[model samples]
Target chain A: MTRYLLRRVWYMLITLFIIATFSFFLMKILPGSPLNAEDKLSEEQKEIILEKYGLNDPIPVQYAKYLGGLVKGDLGVSFKFDNTPVTAILFDRIGPSALLGFQALVVGSILGIFLGLMASIFRNSPIDFSSTIIAVIGTSIPSFVFAGLLQYVFAVKLGWFPVALWGEFEHTILPTIALAIHPMATAARFTRTEMVEVLHSNYIITARAKGVSESGIILKHGLRNALIPLITVLGPMAVGLMTGSMVIEQIFAIPGIGEQFVTSVMVNDYPTIMGTTLLFAFGFIVIILIIDLLYGLIDPRIRLAGGK
Target chain B: MSKLLEVKDLKVSFNTYNGEVHAVRGVTFDLNKGETLAIVGESGSGKSVTSNAIMRLLPEPHGFIKEGQILLEGVDLAKKTSKEMQKIRGKDISMVFQDPMSSLNPTMKIGNQIMEGLIKHQNMNKQEARKTALELLTLVGIPRPDVRINQYPHQFSGGMRQRVVVAIALACNPKILIADEPTTALDVTIQAQILELMKSIQQKTDSAIIFITHDLGVVANVADRVAVMYAGKIVEIGTVDDIFYNPKHPYTWGLIGSMPTLDSTDEELFAIPGSPPNMLTPPVGDAFAPRNQFALEIDTVMEPPMFKVSDTHYAATWLLHEDAPKIEPPAAVKHRMQGFAQTGTKGGGKR
Candidate 1:
């Protein structure tokens, strides 16, 4: 198992290298540069700025410098934010986004899975119908719309939560709900489909014939199998949530990496973009790794099949 | 022996989009304590449906007992609430199904699967359950029960997994056991071993078994009584010897003849002509009339009542009526019956 994990980690490193290389080249190839795009700077002033950030160096030399800096945990200075070190700016913003992402993930997953299971169990009933309707609306409508509706209803009309901004736990509630809605709905829909399929499986029928209680059958036999397929969606789904949260974070003025990442992108701030993009890619790879490990833990068949 | 289970005019139907498919139409049979009654039929003949109905384990909202009484020891199981059925299932009755790979939960340890019924129905605590689970694994001939108990179902081979499933069904020592084609998914040699294992287990526990199968070959020593089902009804039912040696219904004759016996030297194997009648709109008279070459005119017009053939044998066929012309069984069947009587491999049915 450790060997398997180590192998995945090796693969992740290679992936990050490829991503770092491409993003760097893509930034260079674009018609603008951080220094070149500054219209007010004179030719000599632009040259000085370019020299300071190694922009005057050849493309290969710059690429080599970038690679060396990456090895030492450096991501250059952010031109978009008063020439701040990209790493320092990202570190400062990581906590808020992580906090928001973590809460949204936990809340959305638990609630969505619970609701989906209910829909599956009480299938065709009123509760099942309503949860399905909620799930459909959740999947069909975009998160930004949900954010607006939530702000309009909960913030403007009810005055339940503060309209926008992040820091206070209360402030995080509305944005989290908006960010969480899509995942929660997606989770619900997937869980319902998978749970219904699992419930109809032979082993579930065996459990029922074994005289297992309704709750026991649904929980132990049915739910475990149902949850296996959910893992596949969750890894990419987490990545999507992180990237998707940039909009939510911006809308709510969450002061997270997402806010920094977007501002950097608009100004063509290559280093900050590279740093943030790498973080997301790393998170995506690690999340997928964890999910793969979880598959083996949940089902020995997966492990054994891989072993063979 | 006391009557362990009785089904009176039990009819099961599936409400499909087309219409109500009469799966089991007014099938009646009784299982005595310690006896093995094999319900033999082709697929969709309602053999499995009948067994599932008895346990109230039929697929919900559609598959259900349309009309019948599934009486367990004189207490009507059909009248019992689903909650009550829960108590009866695994405690008073248990089931071992087809497909060992599927019958046991894949994620669960073999020991835990066996112990699930024990913990729930027998009220065994965790420790007690674990111990019983180990013992059950051992009982079912699983090697290294201690180690085996910790392993998941996938670790075991198909035959070994089936042994675990049987152990699970036998966990609470239910009075009645329903084995729905338990050996159908197994290899031929493995099939014999499972059947043998079940028979020995039955001897030890004395649980009345309703063994459902399509293979008549498996019925010889395993079954005490055999019911031949066709178009959702039992066309003939008798002691194993009666069915094997003196089968009265043409359908039963066809079933036996279709099987390749040791003495079957003929190059071209006999097959029953035509497929089973569709149960959507069951035939007006005898459901098997279309397939039976010896089918009388009355068989097409009206369903034949169960005619007494002997003390223990009964057949639903107009040929058994006194007024009907005396038409003997096929030449191959009569010869085989005589050969079986002389060999005495199957107990002679008053030869």
Candidate 2:
């Protein structure tokens, strides 16, 4: 098990290194200046500005210098925003987006599992049919569009809550629902599919024949086996929501790292972009690793088979 | 031995998109304590359906008991609500199914599955159930019960897994243990071993077993009584001696003649001609009439009632009717029966 974990961490480091190298070159290739003070600075002053950040060095030398700084946990500085450290900017803005994404993740995944389990248990009934339809609509629409619809229905028509912004619980609810709909739907659909298959399995029949109650069978046997495939999707779904929250943040006008990321990209802020890419990639890699371990926990057969 | 279970004119059907399939049509039997009643038939002849109906384990809203009384210790199970049935199951009656590879919960420890019934039905606490689970594993011929109890289903081999399943079924000492083709999915060697194990275990518990299977060879090893089924009904039922020594139903004769004996030296093994009739629209007459060579004219229009051969034997065929032709069973059956009678009894099966 430790070997499995060690191998995953090794892969994570390699993935981060590749993303860092690729993003560094990709940023250099774009036709824009990170330091936009060329007009105000004399030629010598501009040279000083470029030399201070090692932009005047050859690409390889700059790349080597950046790697050297990365080793020391210095993610460089943002050019578009008053030359602030990339780590500082990230640390400042991480809270709001993480909270919103986490909120959406909890709401969407919980609801989806409930709906999927319901659909699978009472299969072909009206509840199953309607939940399936809802899941379809959720998967088809983008989060922004979903946000707009939620806003329209709750904010404009019903006058139940605030339309946008983030502070009070009411303000976060609309955006959270919008962000969660797709995952909730994905989870519902996948859970339904997997739960249906597991429920029909021969073991389930044996459980019923042994006179285990229906709820006990569904919970202990049916849901546990069903969650394996569901686990595969959950990791990616959370990362997608965390990164996907950028567009959502802009629409709802929430102050979050998502807005910082959007502005950094628009203005060609290399350090901020590199930092954001590495952070999100790191999040994804770690989540996938956790999911791999969860597989062993849920099904001992997986670990035993793999060990053998 | 007192009667343990009784089924009175049980009928089961499955409602499908194509319409209702009358799977088991008015099958009746009684099981006595300390006995094994083997239900034998070709596939789709309702052997499995009849067993599942007794357990009430048939899939719902589609397959159900159309009409019947499943009287366990004189209580009508058919009239009980599902909540009440849950209490009856696993305590009064437990079942072992075919396909051992798929019958056990993969995520659960084999020990827990065996313990579940003891905890639920026998009212044992976790620690007590755990101890009994180990004892059950040992009783079913599983080696190293303490170590094996902690292992999952996939950790065990196919035959070993079946033994574990059997251990689970026998845990609570059910009044009747219904095993639906428990060895059909196993290897031939494993099939014999499992039957041997079941016979040995049967002596230890008073639980009357209803062993459902298609293999007559297996029936000889484990069954005290045999019921040969065709088109969802019992065509012949009698003590092992009566069915094997003086078999009368044409279907039963066909079954016996088609069997591959160790001593028989036939160039081609006889196969029962034609498939079982589709149960979607079952025929009005004896369901086996079309396939029977000696089928009388009346056999096409009317179903024959069970005819008594002896106090302990019965067969559902017009050939047993007085005034009908005194035709003997086919030559192969007479030859096999004569050979079997000379040998005295099946070797190494009786406890």
Interface RMSD of each: 0.9, 0.8
lDDT string, candidate 2, A190-251, tens digits: 99999999998999988887789999999988999999998899888788887899999998
How good is chain A of candidate 1, measured by TM-score? 0.96
Over the true interface, candidate 1 deviates by an RMSD, in Å, of 0.9
Candidate 1 residue A105 C-alpha distance from true site, Å: 1.4
Local accuracy of candidate 1 as per-residue lDDT tens digits, B1-351? 788788999999999999999999999999999999999988889998898899898887788878889888799988887888888888888899899988788888878888888888888899999998888888889889889899989889999999998998999988999999998999988988898899888889888999999987777758899999998999999998899888999888888767766657763455788998888999899998888888889988999999999988999999988899999888767766676677764432222
Report the C-alpha displacement of residue B100, candidate 2, in angstroms: 1.0
Return the top candidate by lDDT. Answer: 2
Model 1 chain B TM at 0.96
Q: Give every collision pair in model 2.
A: none
Which stretches of candidate 1 lie above 4 Å from their native place?
A: A304-308, B342-351
- Which candidate has the highest DockQ of all? 1
Which residue pairs collide in model 1, if any?
Answer: none
Worst 10 residues of 1 chain B by lDDT: B342-351
Identify the candidate with maximal TM-score: 1
